[model samples]
Target: MLLGSMARRVLANAEGERRAPRFVFVIQSNGFDAVQACPESIPFQKYADREKFEQLDLTQHKLPKGLAALEPLKGKTTIVQGLSGRSTGGGHSTHGGCLGLYRTSPASRSAHNATIDYELGRAAPGILPWIGVGMSAGQGDALMHYTARAPHKSMPIILSPEKAYNAYFSVAAGGDREKDFHLKRNLLDYMIGDVKKTRRALGSLGGEELDAYLSAYDELAARQYRLLANKDTLGKSAPKLDDRFTSDVATKRL
Candidate 1:
């Protein structure tokens, strides 16, 4: 009876599982020379006393079959490479290799948003949103997924597995959608007054300008209405994160 009650409670609270879960993952970027996860490929492991200058012909670890299994989802997943913040302020950290992504390091920046996931997940005219997951929660440092300097806000990284699981419901089902409807209604209401005012203002300026402005307004309104009707078709589906894939990405294995 206790088990049944617990299961019932969990189900009741499971936020609507509306669609496929979207996952965003951030990890400490690695260098090409990084050792593979396979034990056999570890060059540092064999060294009893290592000299800084010593060159080790190390073997590389290969990801297991479970990872290769994801080849089926290749089209769904777009592996983007070679992007960075426009500038790093020339700080020594600026000289940073792939490790530079975290913004601040040792563990690296947690929540800076520029890295692909958050951008992709953003709610827009037509797109699936994003959820950032932290795969690089090293003990010494903080974990955040989205990181942007200054004006850009940092997106908190999903740390706990439960947090990640719950977020799946949030993004998948389109969290607080009712609120969005209310908000859109309010926005349209607000636009009604401003739009009329703009028309009047344009008339005062000149007949030609008034006609052009109204025409532009009509075009804009049409675009907004189109977006409203076809919201689902507007964006790419958020990436479905498989556990095996996450494991492969972590530890520089991917």
Candidate 2:
């Protein structure tokens, strides 16, 4: 939620006003001990009120041993504490509630509502609003929705590195990858044309429902155009494929 709010602020700035900030979020499912982040200089009693909010100057105190790696970025970093997750319903794992802040079951395949990351992704539009890559606890699970894009819709987390590489960086790979990209663009074009014909056939019968579908296809077609325009940049930044991408080890996929 904090990242989403910050992204909105940065995006709201007029051109040349301020540079956008890059944000990365890491999720660890293992249990977390509050003391691991609590500085040695601060007393535990200060965090007794879980609902309260407190901010401290990192310059005046040392970060806990676990978070020492953030020393270099202390100036831009903020550590928040005492935020309550009472509504998440305490358990071995909060499932979708970990991000949605509402009770959810691990067995469920859909989300109750949009997650913070989804809202952030939408606020800062892109060809692919968001991409999730993570290891799944279930054996041989190559994809999972530990997150959501909207209510009743779960965002996919690409668990296979090979699949992830192709999904994001394939346009730069040339050969089959580039061919696949063009094929998808062509498919979208066909779909848009078909939808237009259908809408026209419906005439006065068509309502916001048809308009919504048309608008979605239009946005997708626009993304393809943007991708083609930035092909050079994509080629320059695409990661080189290697053994790790196809490694049998689950952690290597990350």
Count of steric clashes across candidates, in order? 16, 0
Model 2 off-target regions past 4 Å?
A: 1-19, 39-55, 60-69, 106-109, 137-143, 188-226, 250-254
RMSD of 1: 15.8
RMSD of each: 15.8, 5.5
Question: TM-score for all predictions?
Answer: 0.31, 0.70
- Write one digit per residue (lDDT tens) for candidate 1, span 35-146: 3322233333423354444333212233323334434553343432233443533244331222234444445534333544444444322222443455544622234323
Candidate 2 residue-wise lDDT, 170-226, digit = tens: 777899988998898899999999989998999979887888778778866876777
**Highest TM-score against the true fold, candidate:** 2
Model 1 poorest ten-residue lDDT run: 31-40
- True-vs-predicted CA distance for residue 158, candidate 1, Å: 0.8
Model 2, position 215: C-alpha lDDT score: 78
lDDT of each: 0.42, 0.73
Off by over 4 Å in 1: 1-67, 74-113, 123-128, 136-142, 145-152, 170-254
